[model samples]
Every structure is written in structure tokens, then in C-alpha cells.
Target: MALRISKKYIHPPVSFLNNHFQFLEISEKITRSKIQSLLDEAYESRINNLSRSIGLAEEALSLSKESADKSFIGKSLSHLSLFHMIIGDFDLSINMANEAIENFEDLDDAKGIADAKYTIAGALYKTNDFSKGLTHLIDCLATYKKLEDYHNLARVQKSIGTIYEFFGDIKSATQSYEEAIDSGKKAGDLNLQSNAFNPLSGLYLNQNKIPKALAIIEESIVIKEKTEDIRGLAFALYGRGKVYTQTKQFEQAEQDFLQSIKIHEEMGEKLGWAMSHHKLGALYIKMNRLEEAREILVRALEYSNKNKIILIKFKANLLLHEIAKKEKNYELALKYLTQYVEEKESVINDRTAKVIEGYDVISKMQALELEANAQREKADIIEKKKIELDSFFYRISHDLKGPITSLMSLNYVAKLEVKDEAALKFLSEYDAQANRLNNILDGLLRLTKMSFNEDSKQEIDFEKIIYDCIASYKFLANYELVEFKINIDSKIVYEAEWALVNTIIQNLIENGIKYARIEDGNKPYISISINQEGDVIKITATDNGIGMDEKTIDNIFVMFFRANRKIEGTGLGLHILKRAIERLNGEISAKSKLGEGTTFTVVLPK
Candidate 1:
């Protein structure tokens, strides 16, 4: 018999009303206050008093509609949507969310629309409309990113990760989880951070990385505890309990599961309580506590059946069959076995129907994607011509470099030999122009070479490569005066194309050095940090230098777009760096202030 552990963990959809409430203005102050208070009460009581929460949200909705405040109506509807979702009324949730979206759109509220979409996505996922859920999630993700709403970004990412995990796309799931954690940190929301941490730890545990899994879950537990997120803590404890179970710490596992069940019961979360009891019963079976296992498994089946949780119901039946067989009750064992098989078949049939529906959605998406791809093919033809143009430029730049080198050498010799002051001054100017041309040609050569070169992966010695980059910039002005702080673990193993990685690292270091502030009594510095997280390599370079304004920062990666003209650059460094990162299928971003400095972050897959 194949046993499957339940992966259905809860991550409550965030309340849209709270975030957008300040933006709303109602003519009737008393009505606005009343609606707002009801919404607040609903949100607060969601986990512990779901019915009450739903009642409060409905009351808010009625009040908002009577007051003719479209924004408040939208918020109230969104709240009701979330409340319905918590109780597994997914269809109702989706309906409410759609109505909320309509009201928000009427009010021209972007945040409200996005938040409602998120709630709809959550409901869609619960209803096994995976493709629709994903589409809505993508929309929500884009809106949140554009708004720079890191909290919502993290929430969306975590949901995306969960969907990917459900579909067996572990790699995409891992990346999404990492992104969620990063966004959560940026948002400074500990609860959101821990929410991502819980699922991420499960992924690690699935890979049998026990130590990493344990550490991650422990960190999540700490954060959840600190925030007094009781529901979140219950989930984290359940996760840690699984880790303990895997490591054969039966006693600890049992205690953890019991604690989780206790929390679930207190919070009046029937689903969580059922799931925790099922897990504890499984643990008891593993520990040979047959009687105890049988009792809890029966209770688990009762709750799951009552709630229509088919997955858990079937699983509990299977365990009960095992308990009956062990106790030598052959007839009872046969009955339990038959029930388990029937329920398992039902689950398979239900899953098959959902999968078919999912495939239909995917087929439609693919049709749209195919149309998009046809357009992309036309674009690719133009791109190919551009590549040819770049090839021609590459050859021209390469040929010009030799002559520029010769011209520079001749200029140097002439400067030494020239007798007249006027002639020598002209020679110096000519030399400067020639050198500038040479630098431009060099930059072009590197850029075009990257465009044409085939990617070849090799083990990256980050320590050596970074130091080499720093060493090359020693002759730059203020290079000696600027402090370099490097933090990299020598043991990190990353593999990528050598040239692309070198280009990314070199340009960032050179930018830091070239733009270093040279004021007396001020210490200019650059900090470089590299670390590997799973299959991704993250490199961050920070500098307290002559930073660019917002407009300049926006255009920094454009070819020949100079930020600081006095600094004497080909203006191709950042452009080339960005191209190199793109060539390697990585991401690069910059954050800066006019005076404070800039930090460039590059993320690459290993």
C-alpha cells in the first residue's frame, strides 16, 4: 500500500480591507466607523470564531452598501471572501471575490482589485482550478511588484510556491519560496517570513536534508512564537513534528503533534485539529502503540468524513485497517480494508476529474502561448538580424583595437620625444582621445563576444575570481584608499559559464572603484558578499560612492548612458554586466540614493 502524507497546510489569505482602509473616504462618519469596526472584528475572529467572523463581515458589507461607499463595499466583500475560504466554502469565496473585484474596479482601486484577485486565486486553488488559480496569482504578483508592496509580494510568492509544489515542480517551488523569504525580509513581516519558512522546510525535509530542515523550521517556530501567531505556530509545530518523526524521535514527535492538536482545538480550526490527530495517530502506529493509534485514527476519520476531507479520511481508514489486522480481528480488518479501498478509489476518481479540468485549462493556456510564440518567432527573426549586426560590430571593434593600441604607443613615444610645448600639449590631448576610443572598443568587444559565445558551465572558484576582479582595479583612482570588504565561504560550490560570471563580478567591482568618493577625511568602501542557497548563487556588491539620481539609475544599464561624466567611463560597464547576467539566465537589480550609495544584486542559477 502506498501511503501519502497530507501536504494541505493553511496560509490564510491576507485581508484586503485593512491595507486599503485608509484610502477610503465615506460621507457618513458614523457609518464608516461602524463598517470599519465590523471588518476589524471579523478579521480578528477569523480563526477562532469563523462563523462570527463571517457574520461580522456580512454586516459590514450591508452597512457599506447602504452608505453607498463602493470602496468599503469592496473591502467588506473581500473580507467575507476570505472568511468563507477559511471554512472551505471555496465557491462562495470565489463568487464574493469576483463581486469585490467589480466594486473595486468601479472605484478605480488597484490595490483592492489585486487583493480580491489574490483571494480568488486562493479559492480557485482550493477548488482544484489550478490553472485559473495560477493565472490570477500571476496578475496579483505583477501588481504587487509594481506597487512595491513587499508584504503582498511575499504572500503571492508563497502561494505560487505552494501551487508549484502541488504540481511536483520542486525547482520552481524552491525558487518561489526563496523569493517569498526575500520579500518577507524586505517587508519586515516576521509572520510572512515564517509562513514561507514552513513550506520551505518541508521541501528540505523531502530531500532528506534533515539538519537544514530542522534549522529552518526552528527558525520559523521562533518567529511565529514571537509574533504570537497561534495558528501559524500550530502549523510550524506540526512541521517540526514531521521532522522529528523522520529522525525517529517518536517521543518528541508525539509531544509536538499533541501540542499542535491542542492549539488547533483551541483555535476551533477543525481541519487543523483533524490533520494533527491523523499525524499523531500515524506516529502512534509507528511506535507500536496499536490501541492508542486505533482510537485516534477513528476520531480522525470521523472528523475528516464529517468535513468531507477525502484525503485524510481515506488515509485514516487505511491506518485503521492496519490496526485491526495487527489485533487479529480478521473480519474487522476486512471491513476496514474494503472501506479504505472504496474511499481511495473515490479520491483517485475525484483527482482524475480535477486533473482533466486542469488539463483543459492548460490546453487553452497553451493555445494562447502558441499564438504568443508565433509573434515571438517574428521577433526572433529581427533579433537574429540584430545578432548579425552585433557580429559585424564585434569584428570591427576587434580590428580597431589593434590600431588604437598602436596609436597609443606611438602617442606615448611622441610625448617623450616632442620638443615644442604646444606640440606636446596637442599630443597629450590626442593620446587621451585615442585611449578613450580604445576603452570603448574594448567594451564593445566584450559585449559582442558575450552575445555570440556559447555558454559553457564550469566550477566557479568565487574566492579566486572575486579577488582577481579586485586586483585588476588596483590602478584606478582611490582604489588604495577605498576599503574592500569581502565575505564568501570558500566551501560554496557553484557552476556557471566562466566568462559571464567574470564579467558580472568584474564590472560591479570596477563600478564601485571608479565611482568611489575621494573626499578627504571620508572613508570610501565597497562590500562584496557571495553565498549559495540551494541551486542559486547570490552575489551582492555595495558601495558608498557617487551614486546616481533616480532617473540616472533607471537608465544606468543602457549603452553609452553615463551617470557621472566626470568619472571617465565608456558607460558600457553596467550595460555589459546586465547583458552578461541575462546571457547566464540570471537577474540583476540596483538600489541607490544620490549620496548614500548603490547596491547591485545578482542572482544566478547554478
Candidate 2:
């Protein structure tokens, strides 16, 4: 005889339910509630959550094997991967994802395979192999597209956009995000679509395209509210707040950031709450509210550390450094600033560097092609000019040399003929002026040569460049008190144009020394530091000097950029440096505070 069900439709007693239920039906499928319960317990960590998750998964694996239900087996495999990810065993997660993928593939289950690939991509993303992660995600996206899995495709695109954003490629990032939004709308996935728009807006904000960013984010916020995805709404609002901060709309930024923090707390998204706090701190600092900034930033730093979000932690520290400086707290400022020094070092081996390297190679090929094109065009336009051009250069070289040599030779002759000290001084001045003119011509010649070089780039020692610049200029002694720091990762090396690298560093370092504040007329100072992350080296030259305003900054690297003609300059140091660095496909930027200091960073491909 079977046991009859005696309990009312309340929560059934465990023993009765277990005994009276048809075990086959109940165990064959899990309800949404049951899955959520397991996931929550697993996420919360039941001291032995790994063991519990594994146990349940293994039990389900056995059951599915007995039932010969491949679908259930695929679910069990996914569960194992989730547990692996939860335990921070990413290698195991990768293996489990692969296994799950194989199982799902065998079942010809596109949906199951999509999920598995996403898990694989997530693991890859965590390990900092963002490119590989992005590849797997794109594969997942293609599968979703075939299965009409618009929702999941949107999710994948959002993440891919994030990787692009991280590398500072706003164009690619925005394109990915817009595709996500379109896909999400088609699938009625407002939450995911809103999520995509929010981050995309932040990217536009960084580019100073305020109107575009604001409009998109506002629409996203509206969608989030309509969908009632409270956490999604919070992040969207928070992202908008970040945009406002960038635009210096401080009041709105603070309110939005605080509102986001409140919502994040209510939703139990602690990491999001942490990021909001840090962003709020940045706003406070901008408003000259240092105390609030410091407190909030500290709270953020603690939370970010626990979550393993180093990017937020580093940025928070950078802001805190600024706040401390405002309070005349140099020690704390220095400490906080040092935290980012390591992370800035980690910018090596990223996708951006790889892309830049690839771009360099492609550009070389393109340049060759362009040269051919230009030659063909020139031949067509000026068939008779080659003889004339050659004759002109020959005449000019010979023509210019006569006067230059005569002037220099007369200066030397005068020195030998002069008997009085006054005549000797006059000859010395003439020689100096003539030599300066020759140096200018030499520089122009080198510049012209750089425009058409076909030589293969080779590795050069950065350490040697630093030392030679110092010894050749005797800049250290010229400065009364200088702070010089060189932090090079000994193994950091690059395949680049050697002569150009030397010239760039020489010009940049010379500028740093010249512009830096000296204790007295006899004092000059400069500091240099180098650090490595994966394959790139970051070189920084910092100094206590009078820094330029935004107007001057806007044109610092433009051709013939002169901030003050009263100050002796060719208006070409940074301009020439930019051209040389660009030839190597390198990036250089300056960060400065008026009457505070300046630091220039150069990122070269390795």
C-alpha cells in the first residue's frame, strides 16, 4: 500500500514529503525556487559551500546517468563549474566549462553550449587574458544569434564592450554597446540593454562628448525604471553621476552618486556600493571638500580590496592622494600615489599595446604602399622635376656650405689673429652663433631622414639612454637640488627605432630639467622612474615646476607650439618628440597641477 498525503497545502513536513512523493518525478526536475535556494546558499558560502555544491552536483550527475538524461547531466556539469568559479578555482572552472561544453555539444543543445561558453569567457576574463575571453564570448554570441538567443547575445556584447572600454578604445566599445542595446530591445531585455547604455555613456563622457553621453544614459535610466531592475537602475544612475563628475557638474554628480550608493546598499550589491562611494569621494575632492572625500575614499578602498577590483582601488587612491595634498598631508598623499605606481606599471601586455604594435607593423606596410602611390603621383605630376629637384638639393647643399664654413672658419681665424681679450671674446661669440645655426640644420636633416627610413627596428637598453643623457648634459650638477628616480623592470625591452627613442627621451628629459624649479639660479632638478607590468615599460619624468594652464596644455605637442616666446625655445621640443614617438607608434601624455608639479608618461610598445 502507498502512503497517502495527509498534509494541507502549507509547507510540507520534510519527512512526509520525502516519503510520500514520487521520488522519480521530483528528482528528475528542479523548480526555480529550488535552484535559487541552492545558488543563494552556495553564493553565501555555507562554510563548506564547495563541498555542498560538489555533493549536490555529483548526486545529480549520478541521477542523470541512471536516467540516461543528457540534459540533466549538462545541468550538473554547469553546476560544477559554478561551484569551481565560486571557490576562486578558475582553472577548475575552465575545465568544467569545457566539459560542460562537450556535454552540451553532444546533446546538440545550443542553449546549454551558449551558457557554457559564457562561463568559459568569464574565467578567461578573470585571469586577465581579456582577448581570449573576448574571443570565447564572440563565439557564444554567434551561437546565441543562431538560436535566436537575443537576450544572451546582448549580455555578451555588453561584456565585450567593457573589455574594449578598459583599453581606451571608445569607438569599438560604443559600437559593441549599441549593438547590445539594439539586440536587447528586440528581445525585450530592457535590464540588459539599460546596463549596456549606462557604461557606454561613461565612455562618451570620458571623451568629453557630454551631450551624447547624457542623452543615452537618461534613456537607459528610464528603461531601468520601467523594467523595475533596481540594481540595474542604480548602476545606470551611478554611471551618469560619473559623467557629471567628468564635466565638473559637481552638485548633480554628488547627488546621483549618493543615490546610487543608497540603491546599491538596498539591493545588496556591495561592490557597486563600494565603487559609488569612491566616485562620490572624487566629487567631494573636486568641490574642495577634502574631509568627506578622504572618509568615503577609505571606505571604498577597503571594500574594493575584498572584491579584487584593483582598478577602482587604484583610482580611489589617486583621488585620496589629491585630497591629502589639499590638506597639506604630503606623507599620506605620497603613500596613496605610490599605490597607483604599481598598477600603472601593469598597463603592459594589454590588448591596446598589442593593437598598437600591430598598427605599427600595418602602418609600415601602409607607408611603403603610400610611398609607392606618392611616387607614382609625383612621377605623373612632375615627370621633369626629378632632375630639377636633384639639381636644386645639390646646389643648395653646396650653396649653403660656403657661407656657413666661411663664417665658422673666419671665427677660428679671428681667434688666432686676435691679441686682446676683447677680440677673443668676440670671436668666441661668433663661433657659438655659427655652431647653433649648424645644430639647427643638423636637426632638420635628421628630421627629414626620419620621414623616409626603411631600417629594421631593434631592441635598445633604456638604462643606457638615461645614463648617457645625464653624463652628456651634466644636468644633475646644473640643478641645485633634484629628485631623480629610475624604476626599470630589468627585463623590460622593446623592438623600436633606437635613434628615435634616444632623441625623444633626450628632448623630453631635457625639457623636464629645464622647466623644473631650482632652489637658486644654479639649481636644477629632475626625477625619472621606470616600471614594468607584462611587456610594456612606463617612464615618468616628474618635477616641481610652474605648470601650464589648460590653454597651453591643449597645444603642447602641436607643431611650433610656443607657450611663451619670452622664454627661449624652438617651440619644437614636445612637437619633435611627438613626431618621433608617433613614428614608433608610442603614446605620451602630460599631467600637471599649476604651481604644484608636472609628470609626463610615455607608453611605448614592446
Candidate 3:
């Protein structure tokens, strides 16, 4: 129910190398001129070498400026605008698009003007200026229609529908999406037609039209699969997963989510990876697989945090709070709760600003389009308030961190000064709780610090890291009986961060021993093996323990997830290991059966 159709299922509008953009017609003069070579190469390399494409466009711009050719200048600026937009430099994209539109207008270039306007609309959309974006899209739609450019006309219509969908204008959005689908079919572009089904499915699903939504999504998946569009297929699968989840068909949903994740990983789509992880993790939580939920959510959090994706981070944190509470670690639960609250408030404020900004833009555009100025001033005032509120929230959040740190330091000092035996014992308990709180705060601070830390990559003696991790486990009470079988080629050197690799191996090794089955009939043992294949180093750790089921394996790495509640732990060991592997630009996975054993595998680029 929470899911909606999205433009992300389609390739981003601003990426110039997309098939739709590449097919746009150019003027005869420009096509025949020397500048044509640069433009052609730019288009060809746009997908494979974006920076080079931009550089070529810049060269064309410089030449055009020297020649004082309005046509060349407009086309070059349009290219630059689209390239910038694709790279997420929305402000620069807007400026360049405006400049391109002006030059195109001077030359009476209708197609050029329309292209520039479309780029401007895309920039506005990226910045959450939805009202202005819709205005530009409408303008571009009219131009493309007049020129009989059905391909582009459908593209603009699809974009307009997406905005309307976001604005909750379902009727208008459905109309626009249908128009897009009709146009795409007329143009014989099944791919574009396939695009319509995604949003349509979402719209139907939101209205609880289950059968209709399923039919539409199935159609989308079939079409995309036939076309062999990897990303499209993945998106369709993910959408289907959402619908299945809502319908409480969890087994089917899990399969769909896993299939989508596999494709996303292959395509290197981090956003899709994060989205599916968040969805699947939430599903696990609902199924009461706390361990698996924790694992997947931690992964979701890492990817979301790395990308500054606030929504997923908020969801991940909220679930982590639940997991911590389920484990009876009230201190850790509160820690996650604090982060969830902060992130939730921040996201709410951000969304509020966008909504206000959208209204402000709409009011101003309406005033201009109708040749009235009465409401423009009021709109400007609203915009100003939104900006001010944004700054205030940011400052307040930063300032709040200081008092938390002070409280932690004061609590530590109180523990050190306590004198009476009874009081000392009570103080010791309080100190443990306070330290847990401090650890959570420290984690938040560490995220900020680690973001800026440069990768310290070098040739590492990985076998040493494994042995050292094994050595650290000797300190664990009653853990000496757990046998370790080391199968490592000491001569094999791996290129990675020493600290991260060490941390990953240490945490994983410690987890194997800590969770080992210690019953009379079972001799707990851990098998650590390391091997190199081409440019990758694969490490496997197998343990005979009270292993997890399929669902548990899915979430074993989640933060604060104690799979074996009988063991004493903070539930952070595997979580930390997973995070460390992420830092090393590697991957970690687990396979386990309840009461049998577990096997963890890590793959790192060498």
C-alpha cells in the first residue's frame, strides 16, 4: 500500500544517451557542419563515458561562441544542460538549459527550443520544483505535438503523468499515462508502451485493484523480459514483489524481491538494491524473523546512508529499533529509536519544503501565464519561510548532539566517583546502560567521519588477519573448546583496506565460536578457508552450530540481532562484519539450516 509507481523504473529522463534522446532529429546545417563530429561522438559516448561526452560538448560550445553561431551555441548548450542534469547538477543544468532556450529562441529553432525546455523541466523535477517542472513539460508537449514528434510527445506526456501521480491527481495522471501508452503504440515502440504498465500497475495497486494490478504488472514483466531489458525486468519484479507483500503472499514476494535484487546487483543499480533490501527486510520483520530482518535492514541502511537516501535510512533505523527491543536490549533499542526519530523529523521537514516550494512555483507560474501578479508576492513569502525552516532544523539537529555527549561524559564520571559497594554495583549497571547509549551516538558520528575517509588500499597478508581474528576469540569464556580449521594460502596477497579486512574476519570468526552448539553430542567446529580466483579473493567460514533457518540466514548480519538468544552479546558482531565488508567494496552472504550449521562466504575485489 505504501508503494507507488515511479519514473525510476524507466531510465532517468536527463540521460542523453537513452534511445529516445538519441533519436531526436537535428538541423541540416548542424548535421552537415564540422561540429557534427563532436556532437555525434558526445551522443555515442554519453552512456559509456559521460565526462568525455560533456568535454566534447564544451569544446563545441567554445567553437560556437567564437563563431557567434546562435544555432551551434543553442545545440551545444542543450547538450551540456542534459549532461549536467544526468550527473545530478540540477542548478547548473537549469542555468545551461535557460541559456540554450534563449539562443534557440534567437535563431527561431523550434525543435532546439523544445529540447532545451524539456531539459529545464527535468532539472526542475530533480530539484522538487514540481509546479515549474509541469509547466515546462506542458510547453514541451505542445511543441512536440505541433511538430508531429510522437516519440517525444509521449515522453513528455509520461513525465507529466509522473508529476501528477506524485501530486495525487490520479484521474489526470491516468489520462496522461494512457495518452502516452497510445502514442507509444502508434509509434511502434513497445518499450515505451511497457513503461506505462509500471505506473498503471502502481495506480491500480494503490486503489486495492489487486487483480488488475497483477495483470498489468505481469504484462510489463513479459514485455520487458522479451526485450531483454535487464533494468526494466528488475523494476517489474520489484513492483510485483510490493504488490505480493501487500496481499500477504509473502513467499511469492520474497522470491520476487530476491530476483529483483540479483538483477540490480548485476546491473550495479545501488538505489534499486537498497529499495528491495528495505522491502524484504520489512517483510522479514513482519514474519518475526528478527535475525534476518536485522541483517537485511542493516544492509539497506548502509546503502541508503552511502547514497544519502533519507527514506530508506529512516525505515531501516525504525526496524532496527524494533529488533533491539525484541532482543530486550532497551539501551540499544532507545539508541535506534533516537536515530529513527531524528531521521523521520528531518525527512518530514524536507518533504514539507518541497510541497511548499511546489505550491509557490505553481502560484507564480499561474500568475504569469494568466498575466496576473496578485498572488506572486504571497508565493514568494511562502518560499522564503520554507528556506528559513530548513536552515533552522539543520542547526537544531547539530546542536542537539552536543548535550547528548555531555550527558554521556557526566554519567561516566559519576560511575568513577561512586564509593559504597551497593552503590558501586548499581553504578556499574547504569554505566553499562550509559555506555550502550554512548556507543549508539558514536556510531552516528562514525558514519559522518567514515564518509570522508580515503580508502587505504594495499597488498594485504589476509591469512594473518584470519589467524589474528582466531586469536582474539581465546578471550571468550568457554570458547576454547570450539575447534578452528584454517585452510588458507599464506602466500596469497589481497588488495584491500587492512583495517576493514581485519575487522570483517575478526567479527565473522568470533561469531562462529560464540554461536557454536555446545551440547554433549556435538563437537563445535569452524572451518576458515581462503582462496584467490582471478581478481577476486573468496573467504569461506563454516561452523557447526545451532544454525538458522532460511529466514534467519536472510537476516543474520543485521545489527543487534541475536540469532541465538541464549548467548550473551550486543548482536553487533555480524552486523559490524557486514559493514566492514561493504567498506572494502566486497560482499558477504550466509547459508544455514536450523540446528545443523552455518556457512558464511565473503567475496572481495583483489
Quote each prediction's TM-score: 0.54, 0.47, 0.46
Off by over 4 Å in 3: 1-106, 123-129, 248-252, 258-273, 287-292, 305-310, 349-353, 356-606
Which has the higher lDDT value, candidate number 1 or candidate number 2? 1
Give the root-mean-square deviation of each candidate in angstroms.
Answer: 21.4, 29.3, 32.6
Q: What tens-digit string does per-residue lDDT give for candidate 3 at 163-217?
A: 7776777997899889989988888877678778888888999999999999989
Worst 10 residues of 3 by lDDT: 443-452
Positional deviation of residue 216's Cα in model 3 after best superposition, in angstroms: 1.0
Write down the lDDT of every candidate, Cα atoms only: 0.86, 0.73, 0.78
Model 3 accuracy (lDDT, Cα)? 0.78
**What does the lDDT come to for candidate 2?**
0.73
Clashes of each: 0, 5, 4
Task: Count steric clashes of candidate 1.
Answer: 0
lDDT of 1 by residue, 420-463 (tens): 99999899899889989999998999899888888778988988
Q: Give me the overall lDDT of model 1.
A: 0.86
